[model samples]
Target: MRYVVQVFASAFRIRKIVNDGEFCILYSDSDPSIDCIYVTDKWILSNQAKPGGYYIAYDNGDSEYVEEDEFKMRATFVDQD
Candidate 1:
């Protein structure tokens, strides 16, 4: 049950959930130390840094849009190696 950690332009840490055993699109990005009970049947994912910025996105059909969300890919960070 691995997870993804994204570094955005903000100072706060960003967490997002990724896929599961079935390879369904349950992707997300969140803090790395967040190890706890996931009590949701759904997943919330983040977005890639865009022209202005980035944000988190989800698809549970509970939004006022009532449609699929349009979000960018995952944001990336480079380690000094």
Candidate 2:
């Protein structure tokens, strides 16, 4: 499965993965219409973060844009468990 996520000003698809207690990483290898983010596989598993959805994952776990109701239109994104 794949999910459309928006991070800041970019949008990208995240290939879905089962949240097992193992390391996982998400990235892109070409000119992506939206930039992809790299997260330690362990991070996702540790956080029990579900895949194949939208979220607002950030260093501070805060972003005004994502808080807006129009977030879905701007870019579909996420990283919260």
Candidate 3:
């Protein structure tokens, strides 16, 4: 299963996500040590960073738009699996 996650973050980090050859690993800006989520290259809609956030369109037609702060809080404890 794959999901499209919309992420809000710095340009530098976003660039890194886009350039990564394998997959997109979302990291928390406040705590760089924490990895928020992982999106494989197969599910990515586009490598380009959009104005609102990083939009990843899911294959099942379900997508999520999350701000950096909200995502950090959720990713801290919630098991995405």
Q: Who wins the lDDT comparison?
A: 3
Give a tens-digit lDDT track for model 1, residues 2-47: 9997434311123333345543232123333333222132323222
Residue 81 displacement (Å), model 1 = 14
> Relative to the unseen true structure, what is the C-alpha lDDT of residue 34 in candidate 1, on a scale of 0 to 100?
34
TM-score of 1: 0.17
Q: What's each prediction's clash count?
A: 9, 10, 1
Across residues 1-81, which tens digit of lDDT does each residue of candidate 2 receive?
A: 999974443333344543334434444222254345545665564545444433344554542212223445665445422
- Indicate which candidate wins on TM-score: 2
Give residue 56's lDDT in candidate 2 (0 to 100): 45
Q: After superposition, how far is residue 26 of candidate 2 from its true place, in Å?
A: 2.3
Any residue pairs clashing in model 2, and if so which? 5-76, 5-77, 6-75, 6-76, 6-77, 23-41, 24-41, 55-77, 55-78, 56-78
For candidate 3, report its TM-score: 0.29
Better of 2 and 3 by TM-score: 2
Candidate 2, residue 25: the lDDT equals 44
Q: Over all chains combined, what TM-score does candidate 2 have?
A: 0.32
Candidate 3, which ten residues in sequence have the lowest lDDT sum? 8-17
lDDT tens per residue, model 3, 1-81: 999986533211222344267766554333344445566655445433322343333456554545446545544342232
